[model samples]
Target: MLADSSSSLAHGHKGRTGLVRILFATRHSLAGLRAAYTGENAFRQEIWAASVMLPLALWLGQGWVEKALLMGAVLLVLIVELLNSAIEATVDRVSMELHELSKRAKDLASAAVFLSLVLCGGVWLAALWHRFVPG
Candidate 1:
């Protein structure tokens, strides 16, 4: 039974396929996005920041590479935040009781979000510096 199920998944034969799979995947992704936005303050804040930064990226960026990098950095924050939120949600769902391992998991996820924010800030700062200061 395990072999059959594994093989089915490996072959993409046990579930939705083709356009149907794509549609389902897209729906699921949208639901996740909605959930993050509704339930997570950090995610909502980052999303709002992205809403502003993305347009600024297009305007301030000197070229395609700069624009892509600037936009990518902002998006990275959102991605990391979403992952962190998922981890936190799963930990909470498992047990509300205080546990050392649970604390570690939440702390690690928070650290990941912080690092992503730092990277995004660095990228934006570099772009601003390059735009305003000539060497």
Candidate 2:
């Protein structure tokens, strides 16, 4: 007769252990959100933007749509910058040679990041204007 390990009481204990493992894994996964948006200049800029905007948002009595737009803009820029940095890091890791194509790719990625930041700034300005200087 084959032993039914799947139905064994030990399997129940294993399930509990798996649940515990998943919980810790989830905690770490959530922690990655902070890291995803972290960099020297990137963090500084994000903090500055938030510091300036948070108060304005509160004062404006921002509705959900405005809040979403503002948050979405900031997050989009930060996430794009993070991805750009990652791409550069990977490219550098692969080779340190001065290849034109690699340099061009990196520059393009950097430009994309800058564009996202610009878009975020535009969104911020529009939100602030609408809040404080409504027509």
Candidate 3:
């Protein structure tokens, strides 16, 4: 039975092929977004930040490349945050006890999120300086 299940998994039996797989993937992605938004306070705050930054990215950017860079930087934060939240959730699901490995994993994920935020801030500041400052 284990072999059968493993073989089925190897063959992509979870969502099958073609349109069914695409639909299932889309559904799962939406569910993940919903779960993150509803369950994660940090995610909710980032969503609000993105809501403001995305439009500002469009308006403040001087050209297509600037716009893309600004927008991508903002989105990158949310992506990193989602991954960080997923790691924390998985670690907690495994065990709520104070384990060094789990703590390390969560901390590393958090650092990734912090780096993404730094990158986003740098991009935005550069753009703002370019637009407003007399340099």
Best by lDDT: 3
Choose the strongest candidate by TM-score: 3
Tell me the spans in candidate 1 whose CA falls farther than 4 Å from its real position: 1-14
Using lDDT as the measure, name the better of candidate 1 and candidate 2.
Answer: 1
Instruction: Tell me the TM-score of model 3.
Output: 0.91
lDDT of each: 0.93, 0.73, 0.96
Better of 1 and 3 by TM-score: 3
Per-candidate count of clashing residue pairs (backbone under 3 Å): 0, 0, 0
lDDT of 1 by residue, 17-125 (tens): 8898988889989999999999998899899999999999999899999999999999999999999999999999999999999999999999999999999999999
Task: Give the residue spans of candidate 2 off by over 4 A.
Answer: 1-39, 51-61
What digit string (tens of lDDT, one per residue) describes model 3 on residues 22-105? 888999999999999999999999999999999999999999999999999999999999999999999999999999999999
The model with the greater lDDT, 2 or 3, is 3
Instruction: Look at candidate 1 and tell me the lDDT of residue 39.
Output: 91
Model 3 residue 126 CA deviation (Å) reads 0.3
Residue 44 error, candidate 3, Å:
0.3
Ranking of all candidate structures by their lDDT, best first: 3, 1, 2
Instruction: Return model 2's CA RMSD, one decimal.
Output: 8.3
TM-score of 2: 0.65
